[model samples]
Target: MAQNHEIANEVLEAVGGRDNIASFAHCATRLRIMVNDKEKIDQNRVENIDKVKGAFFNSGQYQIIFGTGTVNQIYEEMEKMGLDGSSKEEVKSQAKQQGSGFQRAIRTFGDVFVPIIPVLVATGLFMGMRGLLTQPEILALFGMTKETISPNFLLYTQVLTDTAFAFLPALVAWSAFRVFGGSPVLGIILGLMLVNPALPNAYSVADGSAQALRFFDFIPVVGYQGSVIPAFVVGLLGAKLERFLRKRIPEALDLILTPFLTLLIMITLGLFAIGPIFHSLEEVVLNATTAVLNLPYGIAGIVIGGLHQIVVVTGVHHIFNLLEIQLLERTGANPFNAIITCAMAAQAAACLAVGLKTKDKKLKALALPSSFSAFLGITEPAIFGVNLRYMKPFVMGLIGGAAGGFLASLFHLAGTGMAITVLPGTLLYLNSQLPMYILCNGVAIAVGFVLTWVFGFSDKMLNEMKISGK
Candidate 1:
């Protein structure tokens, strides 16, 4: 408790005291601080503070890695010391002000998608569970086969596994509306219109089972069951239109007119204009992603797996959410999940190696738990706190990531989902893919451990840290 206060005081002193702090907030693992002047803070002094893992300037804020529970403790101490911290969202808003337009755009995409990840993850787990239950071998062990399974049980499984993607556009639209400062309920209605049963089913039209409704035999229209980009576009345009209408419409009539007009106009454009154009664009993006992922001999894997963490450092990795969701929508699986899992596992293993090899008790305490967090698919602590803190371990982790990714590609290992990886990722591979998924992560962890053990850590690094008080 006293250490938390001391750390807080040290941080305040390092950053040129309370008056220099413009605003501050803490996420799960870091203290994100905005300063009145970047030059006023001593970056080296802040990083060298005891229990502070690392520090970096990113996304318009000076972020100090404090690792999980300790960050909250330190944040509380800071709060007690007359530092009036902003809410994380408020801090994020200020940080967004500092970012370039492209960074802010990417961050918006992140905000829109993050709220929907848990639902998709649950649906993926359900899919994996269904696959396991229906497998002939697993069914045989239970004295049953696909033929012997009850129709009701099969229907139940479908309900669990198929619902999310079936109405994914609705989810996307709802989230986008919320993020874009519009009514989410209207977003839901608008999204439902896109997938309304009155339209020819999208999959059926694609498979030649049904023909799309056409006007003048030219503009064909179909339901957007699993589409992403169209729903997002509609949500954005709809929110903007709604806001525009709200300002112009009389207050007495606003309640009735705004939603009515907004929905009527957006739904028309959504079906006849935005839906067709963006859905085509979405297909192009999906095809391009597939082509890259299918690049001969794991080339895609090696490149993406090696450099993905580097992208994370820049805070733009959330853009992958779009590509990943598209892949799942089209293919019913996400190969990208396996490759990224290797990267995360390598990070964990490298951090673990550093922990095991280091004699410094403080370093060991930070590294080991950070490594465990990475194993569960959250890698920030392992990356910024431990691995990147020692440059060699990060490099070793990247190499290990590439190696494991190569195997993932060679074995054609993929997951039933995204957003979950490494140990929890095992749930996504619960069917026939379990062994290969395990193997990929095993190779990543092993290579990371071995390489870091042999070359990434040494007594000299510790000596340097001690000498520099870093």
Candidate 2:
């Protein structure tokens, strides 16, 4: 605890003290600070600070990477020092005030998706495990066949794996509601109503085994299971409707009547109108994404692979999680995972090239570990710390990623899961697919390394390679 405070003090000193801070906040790993004067920042000093994993300025925020729970502790110390910290939402508001519409949209998209990844990731791993357990090779090892496998075991795995997607709307709605300053529980209720048993599961309707419940002979009530857009829209509307109801309801009846009316209206509106319209629209989007990803002869791969890390730099990469999840839900495979891994591996390789080329011990220390981390499926350290600082490396990484993605698409490689990638990505392809996954990542890393070694470093970087003797 004392050590944390000491490290916090180092950060405060490095940033030129409290008066230099315009605002301060932290995300899952980065301590995102907006300062009044970028000129006052001791960039080299901050990067060397104890407990900081990496530091970089991006999106107008000087982000000091502390990694996970440590950032929260550092922020608390800052608060105690009378630095007067701002919440992440406040930081976001300030950013929106400064950014263009497109930037704001990207930020908002990240906000919605960040809180939802863990839910999806856990579900994805479970899905992979279910596939692993049911694989014919594994079954053969256990002296069983698919038909001979225990029905009870399949039911358990299926329930664990499928429930998240089946009830995905509720989870997304709850998260969206919380983000929008609404009652999350109520948002979940509305989502559940959209996917109510009475309305019939979407699959049943698709197979013509079930019909939508007709409301007043015209409006077809339906569930939004496995849907995203409708749940998100409904969450937003539910928040607005709740606030509206609160404004008009008498204080005496507010607690009871406001919630009741809000829930009642939102639930009905969600099922009778929003669910049908938005779910169809969502399908259109999913179909469009599939088409774009399926463009002939690895063309889609070239585009997605080349530009993917650019999106990551903007922190909007989480938006792809939805696409990946939806792809897996619909087709039982995710080719995007293979492409994304390639992109990450490229950056990892770029970091390696930078580490090997730099004479500065400080720079070398930062880059090598970052490269390793990126290989292990976390790329931020490599990206923000090294490759982005040398713009050529970032571009090199992108090109490598494009090459790898093209190969992956041409090979038609797919994964059993969505979230995990890079070196750790082998776990996702346990079904005789690990070799192909390795080949894809190898292409990415080798391309990135060769390109960066040849053309990534600037004359300025080489000139500045001398470290100040401590």
Candidate 1 has a TM-score of 0.95
Model 1 residue pairs with clashes: none
State the displacement of the C-alpha of residue 383, model 1, in Å, after optimal TM-score superposition: 1.3
Model number with the top TM-score: 1
Which regions of candidate 2 are displaced past 4 Å?
1-10, 13-16, 36-60, 66-90, 93-96, 214-218, 458-460, 464-470
Worst 10 residues of 1 by lDDT: 461-470
What is the model-wide C-alpha lDDT for candidate 1?
0.89
lDDT tens readout by residue for model 1, 1-470: 24888999999999988989999999988999999988888877886688887788888888988877889999999999988989987888888887889999999899889889999999889989998888999999989979999999999998998888888889999998988889999999998999998999999999999999987678778999999999999999999899999999999999999999999999999999998899899999999999999988988889888888889988999899989888887788898999999999998999999999988887787788888889988898788877887789999999999989988977778898889999999999988999899888899999999999999987689789768866
Which lDDT values do the candidates have, in the order given? 0.89, 0.81
Question: Residue 287 error for model 1, in Å?
Answer: 0.4
Which candidate tops lDDT? 1
Could you estimate the TM-score for every candidate?
0.95, 0.90
